[model samples]
Target chain A: MSATRRIRFTLNGQAAAAEIGTHETLVEVLRDRFALFGARESCSQGLCGCCTVLVDGHAVSGCLFLAAAADGVKIQTIEGLASGERLDPVQEAFLECGAFQCGFCTPGFILMTRQLLDENPAPSEDEIRHYLSGNLCRCGAYPEIIEAVKLASHKVKSRTPGGAAP
Target chain B: MTPFDLVEPPSLGEALKLLEPDDSAVRPLAGGTALMLLMKSGFFRPKRLVSLRAAGERLARIRIEPNGELRIGAMVRLAALEWAPEVRRDFPVIGHTLRTLANVRVRNVATLGGHLAHADPHSDLPPVLIALGACLVLAGPRGERAVPVEGFATGHYETVCKGDELIVEATIPPLGRRRAAYAKCTTRSADDWPALGIAVAWDDDGAIRSPRIVLGAATERPTRLKAAEALIAGRTLDGALLTRAGEAAAEEADVVADARGSVSYKKQLVKVYVARALRAAGAGPAAP
Candidate 1:
């Protein structure tokens, strides 16, 4: 039998720890160990972005990333998009734009969208498509997802000081 | 997934000490993008995994030496390399290839050393790195040694990297006035792996001085078209010369039929893309 390792990392905004096997992926640990089921485990390969999460403020596939490797890293999952009752601007925009159909890939899109908005508050249409191309939507909700990103970008900028829609 | 012991060594020296040349069961883990998949699929069943993230800050940094050479650490993520200003300005081909290497998510964590060591035939970096004349640095119990990227990969999913040796960094000399262009032909969207990839570079005179023509993804490893390069050397870049050079590249490439494409189909792609890449490099840098 293989020995288990204790991993310490920041999940959402809280410090978290888990005793997991060396081979366990972040998606498995997140969904099974900690019961944070926001990130889906569709395609375990890195090709699919269903397991996308923010690692150190950048989006990455959780399924392809080992849980033990995430020690001391700050990770943001789909469950963290809302604070208490208030939803993040991206989350709010996702709903307003009706960005999901089957909803299996919504969490990944939301997390990736959050990352995009955080990095570039104002991204062009080409930039948006280029960035989000990794995350696949099986329900063909990409059109709405793109719209959500645009809407969220506007909402996010409007709330910032000295920022307004041009 | 199979069970394995995880050892997080605090330094490169310590990690080296933990490795043994005869211990094939001990594997070094970096980024975990490709390795994890293999482990999960039961294709690789290593008994122990040495985590390199514990090598700390030094191994993760991309350094520009005083001599203007670029040293990319083994742990520097692909996304970081893609947007790095030095890479964009000095080695734009590296950045250009990185943009289309994989999707945004994979780039966020996949590292250069891991990618090179992984040595997947369809990967984008090996061909470009070989074209740039980059050297890979490997550290082990015997200390560090350098190997040219061209000779790094021995076969599919294989490299000169021994079980005890770990790829620590890749150093690239200054490009100077040389301009490079890379073209990839994928079966589907841009996100898919290349069915055929072509990387071409030329000197300031634009006369194919020390020309490098590489065709990737069609063979077991990145194949250099030395004959094609020789044919174009000292010759002006023109449609006729380029088409002849492309035909030579197609002939030299040992293409194999796979799910991505057929052997003849890939050879045809190599012929067209080699010429297209040479023209593109001669024209100017395409917008990233």
Candidate 2:
């Protein structure tokens, strides 16, 4: 069975193309074809959020996502979060809160937090915990991660026009 | 995962034509979450996959009919289904159950059809759907046929669907005056697969009538707790009645042991969660 496919998609706000085997997962393609290592695959299974990527503005496990399925979609990885030399607000909050110890799982946690804040700008502690439950940090930095999410929420709200009070 | 030919069929007719009726190696792919897991593990080596992602928007619409029946297209994502106002307003049990399913990312990609078609008995939706008397419309080369969700799965990872057939949509009847709830007992994390899952529903104007209790995850298939349903049929729910119903469910279910728990442990969970589900359903439908 020969199933090599060519897919074109918008990556990190730029149009890109890749010739991938039908069997190759999106994470594999992202790392191999585009040299984007921010979205690394730790747990090949979808249970771990280590491979989270945004497809059309929704989070999906890239390890389980077939590269051939990336055609005609807008994909965002952790690498796409920062512009030029400035870090996204979520990245700043994570660094300020010291949310990671090993940093292997940092990219995934940060990406998930970005989505969480996009959905709920002012999430309560319980809401934040519930949303981030899918992600796991082996360093056991959950307390700090929660703090980072709260900080990021505040940072995001402040950046919004006239909604800084939250 | 071995390399396999992938065909992106633009329509359901083209997708169905791509699938060989007797070839198990040729299969339809929807959402790709569940199948990707199988492919990664090498347990399933598909010769050809008919990708349904481009198979038209008719497979993605969620319509609430005038009769209040929910006609959910097979390809509707779980997260969309969870957040749909019509679902939360009419079928709150579905919304409540989905809130605790696998996780946000999986929910965003996994479709309702794949969830049922995969027939992973540990899933939360089947038992809940069985309790609500949901029906699946299976489209095949011949035509479409409707099957009740209760007997759709014959065993773990087994279903009545033929190799060539694809689930087109799921139709949930109007909840009307009945209240329903699903209770799952996860031995590990809160979002982990349940050691035991119990879904119960019935008419609740004054007395419980036509009570449907289905136990899942702890069993081979979604098993109806007929003895338990019969136990509480015409009675107003009270503590004593709830205990008796729970006991009946625990005795009637044919639970099997796995990583989730042992047979004895799951039997105990069955007793506890059955009562919890009935109590929750009796407390009245949840607020939107």
Candidate 3:
């Protein structure tokens, strides 16, 4: 097999390109190649959300996503969530709520909630629960995780200029 | 995962040209959610992984035709369909199914055509699409052809699609005045693959129409409960009729035992879910 594929995509808002093999997944390239270690790789099947990342503003399982297929797409990892000295609202809420114990699943949950709140700023309790159902917290931190999302929603809503877009 | 050459043909025509009708080694990558999983498990090792991203916008649109039909491009993401105003307005069941089918992460990347092509009997979309009278459009080096959703899947992880052919889009007919409902019973979480699923569509008067019932995830294929359909074809749905139809559905499906449940258990679940789906579709008041 020839590793002749070169993919050009936007990573954390910057143009990036990498030589990839057809078998290489997004998680491998992100953690192994670029050293973006935030997106955890566990249960490589799409089942576990540990490897979740934002591809063009939508959350996707990095382990199940082919880096070669992501050519020309925008990718956001947990490493990109914080800006210099400030944490993203989702990250702040997660920490504030103590949403992680072991924290292996924290990055995936944070990213999922970020996208969730972005899409629906004022999601109801059921909506929040339903949206985060895929991102499992093995530490049994679901109650706090749910709380974090609720708090993050309020934080996001207040920060929006007119609170029009979620 | 075994390594393979990544081929990106800029246009649909170029992609088709690269695909040969008899070459099973050339696999087209859609959202890569399902395909990637199989590759990770070492189940699928392709000689060439054809990335359709180069096809770009040509295969990524969702169009509501003037004739009241909904035309969805193959590459349209599941999340896009879940939020599409036209899809939500016309076929709300699809939106309902999408919400619980998989997690937000999977939906955001999983494509419509890839979902169908994966052809998993336990999928949430197949039965609903079959009940909605949808058709899948396939384009190949030879030519283009359309297959009704009901006849698309030939078996588990299989379809009528030729190796050279790629699913272009799927067209669902207008819902018109018919009300539809989908009921999926999972062994574990609500998001898990259904142990048994029932999708029922009927007219305003509760009379069964051209398009009818389909039981999914409980059988090898999207099994149309024709015996149950015949039981209520011309009758206005009532509690008794739905109960009777449910029984017919259980008898019609060729259920097999699995981790989800035993064969007999699934049959029983099918009966109950079918009745529940019928009632949800406004099959009159429930029997006392």
What are the TM-scores, per candidate, against the unseen true structure? 0.95, 0.97, 0.95
For model 2, the stretches where C-alpha displacement exceeds 4 angstroms are: B286-288
Expressed as tens digits, the lDDT of each residue in B85-173 for candidate 1 is 98887788888888888898888888987898889999998888888888989988778899999979988998888887888889988
Task: Summing lDDT over every window of 10 consecutive residues in candidate 1 chain A, give the lowest-scoring window.
Answer: A1-10
Which residue pairs in candidate 2 have backbone atoms (N, alpha carbon, C) closer than 3 angstroms, thus clashing?
none
True contacts kept of each: 0.89, 0.89, 0.87
Question: Which is better, 1 or 2, measured by DockQ?
Answer: 2
Model 3 segments beyond 4 Å from truth?
A163-166, B283-288
What TM-score would chain B of candidate 1 score versus the native chain B? Answer: 0.96
Score candidate 2 by lDDT: 0.91
Clashes of each: 0, 0, 0
CA shift of A164, model 3, Å: 11
Q: Which candidate should be chosen as best, given lDDT against the real structure?
A: 2
Error of 1 at B107 (Å): 1.2
* Candidate 2 structure quality by residue, lDDT tens digits, B1-288: 889999988999999999997887888888888899889998999999998887888789998999889999899999999999999888989989998999899999999999999999899999999999999999988999999999999998999999878999999999987889999989998768888889999977688888899998999998999999999999999999999999999998899999989999998999999999999998975322
The DockQ-derived docking category for candidate 1 is medium
lDDT of 2 at A56: 90
